[model samples]
Target: MRMVPMAEADLDAVLAVQAACYPPAMQEAADVVRARLRASPDTVLVARDADGICAYLFAYPSRLGKVTPLGSRFTLPDRPDTLYLHDLAVAPRSAGQGVARRLTDAILARAGGLRHSALVSVQDSRRFWESLGYAAAAGDGVALATYPAGALYMARRLSA
Candidate 1:
């Protein structure tokens, strides 16, 4: 699969992939996802193979210890030090095809001078993020509470 910047046209497919990956309680509405895309278009991406978009990754610049509560709009910081990976979903059919890794790598490659990268690991995907060098980290308690049970806030320092 090839990685490309997420476009408005990809929203439908992105939503489909998201629905297929996450439970109803964990899913964010389309409007929330669209607003995030507009807020930081450069950090959102979609993976496409011959069939079509099979995965997506949404990220934004923010403080390392902060957590974006589910369904809330992203409030970008004036002096961001971390790239927060907000969401990542791969179509069930595309699982194990390296699509998620490809999208993650692409976003990290675009992180520029950020000092770290973080994400909220849900749906029991902690091992996947851990394999990518992330480790459980503290986050805003109130914000973290918005997630389902067992969700973890994870982060990793970036190499200069």
Candidate 2:
């Protein structure tokens, strides 16, 4: 699958692949996507194939640095510089491929001109994120994960 900038035409297919990859509580609904797209269009990316969307990456600028989101409260800051990756999902049917990496490359490409780091709360796939050069969140008590199967708060500083 090839990575692409998400557009209005790709919303339904993107959401479908997202739903297939993650649960409702963790995935953004159409309304949320609309809101986020309007406010933060630079933070979304999608990978597609002949069938449809295969993977996606969602991000937002965060000035709060690496404040880990626990439960429902996310530590968002106004006009932040750091790129916070909210989620990365590849459809179950597309797991073995390099879709996630290409999607991530798209996010990194977007974040390249920024001044802050790249952050992600990794879920059920610690090794995957590690392979991409993301490490556990800095400092003590940073290992907490809210995901049902648990996850790690990981980040990598983007050279500015």
Candidate 3:
């Protein structure tokens, strides 16, 4: 599978993979996902093969320490210091295939000028993010409260 910028035609498959990867409570409604795509098309990436989309990463440029709430739209800032990774999901078919790492490398390659990166590590996935060099950081508790209790706000410094 290869990672590429997501297109409108890929939304359905992306949403399907999202549903299969995340629990119902963490799932974003179709409308909300649409809004996110519309708001920051350049930041969304999709990986696919003959079977169709199997992995995706939704992210956008934003201020450091800030996060987009679950199922909410994002507005790219005029000057962004961080690349906020909103979601990264891989379908069962793509599991254990290094799909997530490839997509993440694609995002990082495109974010070379950013000062930092941030994400919400949910469902006890902090160890996974930690492996990528992200560490827990103080964030908006109220904003993060919308996610499950295990969610952690994590950040990593980027070479400028």
Tens digit of per-residue lDDT, candidate 1, span 1-160: 7899999988899999988998899889999999999999999999998999989999999999999999999999999999999999999888988888889999999998999999999989999999999999999988999999988999999985
Candidate 2 C-alpha error for residue 33, in Å: 2.2
Candidate 2 or 3, higher TM-score? 3
Is candidate 1 or 3 superior in lDDT? 1
Flag the better candidate by TM-score, 1 or 2. 1
Task: Summarize candidate 2's per-residue lDDT along 24-140 as a digit string, tens digits.
Answer: 666656776655555567777888887888877767777524554433324457667677777678888888888888887778777745665555454568788778887776522
Q: List residue ranges in candidate 2 displaced over 4 A.
A: 64-79, 138-149
Q: lDDT, candidate 1, residue 138?
A: 93
TM-scores for the candidates: 0.98, 0.78, 0.96
Stretches > 4 Å off in candidate 1? none
What's the candidate order when arranged by decreasing TM-score?
Answer: 1, 3, 2
Query: Model 1: which residue pairs collide?
Result: none
Q: What is the model-wide C-alpha lDDT for candidate 2?
A: 0.68
TM-score of 3: 0.96
Which structure among the candidates has the greatest TM-score? 1
